[model samples]
Target: MKKTSDLEEQLKEITQQRNLLLKALDVLEEGIHVVDSSGRTIIYTKGCEKIEQSKSDYILGKHISEAYELDDETSVQLRVLKSGIAVKNHHTSYITSQGKRADIITNTYPIFENGKIIAAVSVNRDITKLGELTEKIIELQKNLYSGEQKRRKHANGTIFEFDDIIGESDSIKQTIKIAKKFARSLSPVIIQGETGTGKELFAQSIHNYSSRANGPFVAVNCAAIPESLLEGILFGTSKGAFTGAEDKSGLFEEATEGTLFLDEINSMSMLLQTKMLRVLQNKTVRRVGGNKEIPVNPRIISATNVDPMESIAKNQLRNDLYYRLAVATLVIPPLRNRLDDIPILARYFIEKNSKIMGKNIKYISDEVFEIFNKYNWPGNVRELEHVIEHAINMADSTDTKLSVQHLPPHLREKFTHKHHFYKDYKVNNLQQTLLDIEKDIITQELINNDYNITKTAKSLGISRQHLQYRLKKLNIKKQK
Candidate 1:
């Protein structure tokens, strides 16, 4: 019994020393975790806190059966726990906060000490910078491997130089010149215009022109994606925030060191407007379930169709956020206002689509110009393009001579068709012009009616003698 007791004491001492070494190693080693079979977390380190964005004290002494989630419902812990195996080296993504975003490299291991499962340890390494470096290498390789057949987009997704754009209009030329200058600066710019006015085009021009054009040019349509999805798309979430998280890289993250073009920013819900305001303010963002703040360095270029001030008054936007975004505002002239450029823009599209559709056609009639200049276009350039395309498809001749008949009915009715003169003549200035031109018309009508005063009065919607006297003052003869 005495010998047995001595052996037991010696074994206890060895176990104590080993455990001491382990605790010390846990402190010294960079990444650490303590997870149990339930896929619930038991404890994590300061390094793990830096990685997983979780503090040990906050999660201590609880039933660590729930696995960490990337979105809402998806869980790494649940998967690891149920399978009774370790999940190793899975990649996860981040929401771009400031320029300093991060990606997580994850490894999950089943915990065992003396032949029994106790906990799991997960190690995560941030790969934000690695991603950027890889992109650089890819770009370099492309430049090297295909030196003969060179085709590349500028960081802002545009080709450099006047030769890049195929328009000769003074407006487009001037706009491009100004845009190249705008790209050099880092300040926020507001692209204001009607929908389909090429606000995106200008935004891309500015981005490609800027010094930071080497970065990503991520275009996000605020109106296209719903608010719920946008939060995760913008800020990003961990392995599990709510569920089913495969880990996503938000647009903000994708645009690191580049420009983020928020198209139709006016359509963003007011709640997201407030959240966006916070991003602009801090230049750092916390993921949906993450505790650590990540930095981001991308430029923000926001576009809106509505007047910024009007949007604020309507309570659809936060005034503070508008001010930040509108630090530099560029109002893209509407297609109607820039009517001088329509011919060039039209030919460009026609040439492009014609090449694609295997059609060789050219020319626009002067009457087509008359219709174009006269029509009050509600849909702007996009509408015009559609109209031209329709006209082209319907044309019997190879030449692109679009006439009044070729115009869509809604557009054609406002001009000089005989059936529409009366209703089409409704205008204030023309009303005054008609008053002067009417007496001669009145006498002509009266003569046609054989000067029957009652019939003339009835037709003119006035007394017969009143019409005759007016004809005399204007010297419109009472024809025999």
Candidate 2:
């Protein structure tokens, strides 16, 4: 009798402990509630006031269904409490004060007493904003295969294959062949290029071609994230690793058995660079404040607009890390070096963005070609995309032709240069130097005239015969 009495006392103490824990949980800033035996929400925490976007005094005694409505699928979670079972991370929708709906994920567990459920405890997390931000990833993916189109990616979206690579140039084709071969190996690869040269596209294409195509293609912008938060974000933290932290997975870990593309990697701090180097060497990562080492087999791909060597010289990136990264590097040529591809790339972007922006774009005019040919595209592919998109918008919506006159003022500057007169005509020491000067002058004249010889000569304040003589003598081919 005495032992059984002592045992009952111990049970009472345990019950008290549970009650105290429940009270502590209710006081948390996170949304938490308790449904007691009578199906009354007996414990209403002010934590939920913010998530429901409601005032603290308004929610205390409301029914579970009365306080929040559910979408079609998550409404079934109500049965879990009724059946005395536990459910977690069940995604549901909530009607906010503005009468707009948002997504909230909940974790619910039934509290048992003497082998019977006495109550249900729930924690709700709002994730609607996060869900929308997640769609930007699809935007990045679409940017890869889209050429000039603006669209977001979805699960059902078509992934890029080798055929999606649009270039007949030998260098581009050879680069693709090497990329495809390396993609099959699933090793770390670095793509080096100037800004807007399609580094992410190549990364995505390589991922799609790899064995890990079915897994997530996680891309993180090292430059975009702040250094303070970057470390925690790259290597996730344990629950309450610091104040207000829930369990979060870092990009490298989240991309387990997949590919993790760290863009503008030179932006990572020196401290984080050391941590990253270890992960690269060990194929493992330790969470912040976590002692356990996790083996990650994700393929690594990094890209940068700035030259990696230059970055290393500035101490932005470690020289040792640079050597590890450049085992197989691919350098993308600027658009000026690949002028033959300009028309093809331009028309592709015009047609695609036109369809998306609902503008009618039919053809590129000879004037547009002259504009394309004369100017060096310093902004590369991305600049071309935006310029064409702007042209589509500025032209008559029904008009299908794009000409030089339609281009913006800034774009016109590329083809414009002030003729510098040498006071002495004998400045050239070599025939090549004179030829070069005359070639530049003739080219400028052609651009000023829209490549029309009569108009060009008139612009140069000279006769067409004189312009033709100089162009021929200098062996300068006038743009057609």
Candidate 3:
């Protein structure tokens, strides 16, 4: 009788332990399910009920196949039971008996009893929401970067406006006045300027000042894209047109009721020019492989570094296209032509760069301005901005003023050889002429060798120490 009572007590403890483990499994976020070797479900937690959208009462004692309507090949638990091998992070999609769809990632492991398959356990994670979120993120990225070769040239954003254009010169003012006037008109405007003369800046300013300011401002560089893809880029492609091609909107369609700025328009192919002329004439565009004509009403703003007339003469730009695009032409003068604005531009850039670089640059030396005015800036305003940024970075932390010492080695060399000797010679007597000439030659050699003391000395057929002495005597500081 005592043995029977002890056995009953032991069985009660085992059942309580099993119930505690089942309760623990039920609290987990991941679905926990166990099936016997015969494929009958032995355990089904509340998490499984939530994941499958079914009650445990229906699945706990039934065959997994009958309850979930899944086969041995589809059910991860049954696969593990049959194979005696664990399956880790297997993805599956299924429709539940209640008609609810679910995407799940599951891990299934077989239970071993003395090397014999007894049961299988599956841990399921419902990732339907995560999958939906991932899909949404991918779609947003596609919308931002979708095009042939993933070209984002016509991405919808503007970085500059009329107020951002920094120039007080009369020529720049006149250009701005014409650009403002062109903004009010829907006619296509052509901007001609040297590279880096802020052609795109004017395009953005016009877009911001126009009636289409609320819409997207798309910009594309004709020279940046391949010639073969220009047509499809300007006019969209339809599905079934080619392998891997989908129904895609071109820049013209994408910029509907907005502004489309085509930069370096002179680089467009002749065939594209003819197509563009037709679109400008009819204000309609047909896709590359489709016959349907789409009426696009976007404001056109084209820019070129080359002269439009010269481009036409060289067969680079179509005469008819030029005439249509140049209805309100705005020519931006180069930086050298507007020397009067250099001081203001320099001060503005200094302040701007100071804030960006966390510096306290208060002044630019007169010598620096003299060199800036003398150098012919082939790269224009953009080059000037870069030069200022370079100077700010080269300036000493303790120095509040930008000086010739902070200038780039090339500019410093040019300035030292060109102006410093002549100015000093004129002020001093004729006795210093020979010394000044020698100093100029030594300085030029030092610069040519990138301020290498040994190389400059060797090129001058002197010792490194002697060159150092000459540099100090000439009051020229070698950058450390």
Against the true structure, candidate 3 has what lDDT?
0.81
Residues 1-480 of candidate 2 have per-residue lDDT tens digits of 999999999999999998898678767877876776545567666666666667645555655566555322334335655677677655545565445665556788888899877777788776657645554653564355554332534242335566666667777778788888888887688898888878887888888888888887887888765555567678877763432345667777878878888899898989889999998899888887577788887888899888888998899999888777777787877777777788888889888888887888888777677777777777888888888888887766756777554677786565544654322455547777777776777776575444667767876789989988987777777556
Worst 10 residues of 2 by lDDT: 148-157
Sort by TM-score, best first: what order?
3, 2, 1
lDDT of 3 by residue, 1-480 (tens): 999999999999999999999999999999998898899889989988898788888777788778765787667788788889898866566767576776777888999999899999989988778756554643453354444424523334665688888889998898899899999978899999999899988998899888988888877788865554557678988764432345788889988999999999999999889998898788898886688999998899999998899999999998988998988999999999998888889899999899889889988876678888999999999888888999899876766877766778788777665444444456365658777877778866665455657767987899988888888888876445
lDDT of candidates 1 onward, in order? 0.66, 0.73, 0.81
Clash number for each model: 33, 1, 0
**Which pairs clash inside model 3?**
none
Per-prediction TM-score to the true structure, in the order listed: 0.56, 0.58, 0.58
Best candidate (score: TM-score): 3
- Error of model 3, residue 72, in angstroms: 42
- Which of candidates 2 and 3 is the stronger one according to TM-score? 3
lDDT of 3 at 332: 94
